[model samples]
Target: MYFTDRGIEELTARRGDESVTLEWVSDQLRTFVDLHPEFETPVERLASWLARLDDDELDDE
Candidate 1:
């Protein structure tokens, strides 16, 4: 399994039952990036991808 899957699993186990809004998630990502600048690019990409996830083109990726 991919190493990142462990973190994903942990998140699921920890907070999967909670309800969250997109704004909450966006704020969290921004806070994370503020604390961990090195991950800004990846976080930005994820945020952008999520923002445009409904677009037909990204489905192909």
Candidate 2:
């Protein structure tokens, strides 16, 4: 997914000093999907898959 500077800043702020959790990141991705349902298949599938991955898995990506 593409992130604007503001979006990245917001995410960074939310992430704070602690490592981000998969569940938390997934919730953000789900909200993004809910807001933008018109995106193509693989993007949707990827987002869904990302929602299921462990935090370390996501971090590695």
Candidate 3:
């Protein structure tokens, strides 16, 4: 498994039952970027991917 999977698993385990809005997630991402500029690119990519997820699924139909 990828090393990043550990963090993903932890996130799932810790917050799996919580429901959050995209706005909140976006705010958190921005806050994270503010604290860790070095992760800006990956975070940007992740945000873009998330923003396009529904459109991407539409393409499969």
- The top-ranked prediction according to TM-score is 1
> What are the models' TM-scores?
0.90, 0.41, 0.87
Q: On residues 1-61, what C-alpha lDDT tens digit does candidate 2 reach at each position?
A: 5657788788689866788777876777677767887754656688767566876676776
> Would you give me the overall lDDT of model 2?
0.72
Superior by TM-score: candidate 1 or candidate 3: 1
Which regions of candidate 1 are displaced past 4 Å? none
Global CA lDDT computed for model 1: 0.94
Better candidate by lDDT, 1 or 2: 1
Candidate 1 local lDDT, residue 26: 88
| Each candidate structure's count of clashing pairs | 0, 0, 0
Please report, as a residue range, the 10-residue window in candidate 2 with the lowest summed lDDT.
39-48
Please, what's the RMSD in Å of model 3?
A: 2.5
